[model samples]
Target: MTLETKSLSKMDFVYWTSLVSGGVAGLVVDIVLFPIDTIKTRLQSERGFIRSGGFRGIYKGLAPAAAGSAPTAALFFCTYDGLKSYLGQFCSKTQQPYVHMISAASAEIVACLIRVPVEIAKQRRQVISLRYSTSLEIWLHALKTEGIRRGLYRGFGTTVMREVPFSFIQFPLWEYFKQNWTAVTGTALTPFTVAICGAIAGGIAAGLTTPLDVAKTRIMLADENVSKLGVSRILHGIYRDQGIKGVFAGFVPRVLWITLGGAIFFGFYDLTARLLSSDQAK
Candidate 1:
């Protein structure tokens, strides 16, 4: 609840710590779990799971995902930590959850600038790997033919819609879990404990937001014309066509993937930040 908001200097140790640690966490978790993500995408694809190359070529989207994950996460934590510190100065301890929520929402907005394009290319490749030999090929095809908005950033709005609510749920709970653990143990939580908190929070958030995620995935994998129908229309169509089960496509895989990813990401982030902070103190 307390933050030392001395100033907004990017040269500060905490800034670099957040940037590097978040990057490392994001890159490692995303790459390790890329296959699970591929499965989730195929399951959510309009082409149907088996027809969309089910289990074949699971690493189809690794290139763009790897390239984008680090920076996007770096940007997220940088924005999140900085804003949390800056904004913490304006609120009471009881209001800290709102602080976390606002910071995370802002961070997600910033992160999505890069995440959306990578997601578009990544999901597309995951579902249609045979149609394109490389991730770059998909990116080029989208941009060249569809232009930026409808192509590379095809699901930008829905992604923000999904990610914002996800952050709203996950971050507040992650912080709350850490606070509770620290209070109960009379000591700060270790990276592993923090990770457990993250896994719990992330799984809950992912499960709750599966429908929004399904909409984002559907929009991305849908034809260019379908992209224009928007999130509401897409959701309606999915419900009308496939029923309630259709709206929650890939729910299990999504929750599973995110639970594992949250542990890796938050645990490594804490470890990396602690290491950097220790080195700075030394």
Candidate 2:
């Protein structure tokens, strides 16, 4: 096949492959790491961690997370791969980083449509005071009281803010890491290598964006009156009251959770994609 033909085929493959692999990866990582994520969310909540259930009910939000993780991840990879392929045609090799950033950011925006709702439900349930009997109940309650935009889609803007910059940083760095490793070794990239790169990139991104993340969690779990203060005001409030420390609440767990999550997610995704590709080649 010609290079163009090969590219098209790759994009075509991504449609199914990304869905399957991303779903599997997302489910595994999210479920396996639920407790850590709970801890992180509680830390970032406006309520103190001790007051937000502390170590109790770590899996309270598992239902929403389990339900949303697969679709959100699948959508992200499909959009990301498709965009990367289409946009790459218009950019020089040297400009590929920008293409990756754009692709990742776009994918994140699309994924956030699902992710924000999941987050709203999940984070709220993670806190004891905000606990709902079920994910569906959480949604119903939010919709009833706050409506869609303020309730179901609470924290959408802050989520996009946190996620887009995260993708911009993480995806480019991941691509760069993989590229350099392949160039230096003159070998095909492996799932393990991809995972290592993902871990590093995710850790850096998660650490740097902790404040935005804190803001997102707070917004999602906040009462209507408090949430109306908006991301900027909430951020300022946190900074004013607690200084830099409060802004970066949950920094440790956030970094650790994402680092491990990235490794598992990308590792499984690469492995599953390769398996599917090999099967197709037969």
Candidate 3:
């Protein structure tokens, strides 16, 4: 049996396209829904939902998140697309879904390297009383005080626990929905369709992972005392203190943020890809 092979160089277009598109999509999503995310973080914080300063500083950490969103998203899609393309050469059509899953997982892991530090800065800034003016200041202070591993990447494990499964649940579901939507409607999958599918997948994934998210948030934003506690211990504390509902604090806003953000991220990504490819063809 002969397998058709194309030059890997052909994928250069996909690499650049995914990078640019993912960046744009991520930036838009992060900036637009930043307020919701602020609220969610506040809800998940150890301080509970009654922090001072009111809604005035809802966009407090928007800078770091917005700045990081582009690069993080670009890295994820670029890695995901590259891996998927490479894997496709070896895997049969029947095995494509598994390949996608593996690719997405790989992408998420790599993306986390960039994402974790950004999250550390963002979450810490969010819970504070706006003492720091910029994400850079927050990061520098944390680095000086807490050191790298403990400071900038405090919740790395918990974040991975939340995000990896989120990718696992989200990407496959998005693919499945897109395929089925195309089959049923007899129409090509458009950005709108991709957005809808992404929204559903993201919402489900975010909702399911809320407990892990709460754990991650607590770990990242924890003070010296709480920071000493292990993830299991912290989770046990949440359960012990506030019950099951506490474990899922900020579920509604998280779902809303992720769902809408997913829609915008995916929709813009697809739209950008289509436009880029069209330009290349012309």
- The segments of candidate 2 whose C-alpha lies over 4 angstroms from its true place after superposition are 1-10, 185-188
Model 1 residue 134 lDDT score:
75
Residues 1-282 of candidate 3: C-alpha lDDT, one tens digit per residue:
223334544678879998999999999999999999989998898887767234667878888898899999999999999999889899997787888889999999899999999998887778765366778887888789989888887777788888888989999888889879978888888999999999999999999999999989888877757877777888889999999989899999999999999899999999999999999889
RMSD of 3: 2.6
TM-score of 2: 0.95
Report the C-alpha displacement of residue 34, candidate 3, in angstroms.
0.6
Candidate 1 residue runs with Cα over 4 Å from true position = 1-11, 185-188
Clashing pairs in 3: none
Question: Candidate 2, clashing residue pairs?
Answer: none
The local lDDT score (0 to 100) that residue 245 gets in candidate 2 is 92
Where model 3 places Cα greater than 4 Å from the true spot, the runs are 1-6, 52-54
Residue by residue across 1-282, what tens digits does model 1's lDDT show? 225454434337667988999999999999999999999999888889999988998998899999999999999999999899889989999999999999999999999999999898788788863477777888888889999888888889899999999999999999999989977878779999999999999999999999999999988887778888878898899999999889999999999999999999999999999898888778
lDDT of 2 by residue, 1-282 (tens): 899998678778878898899999999999999999999988887779999999998988899999999999999999998888889999999999999999999999999999999987788788988657888898898899888998899878889999999999999999999889888877778999999989999999999999899888887887788877777889899999999999999999999999999999999999999999999899
Full-model lDDT, candidate 3? 0.88
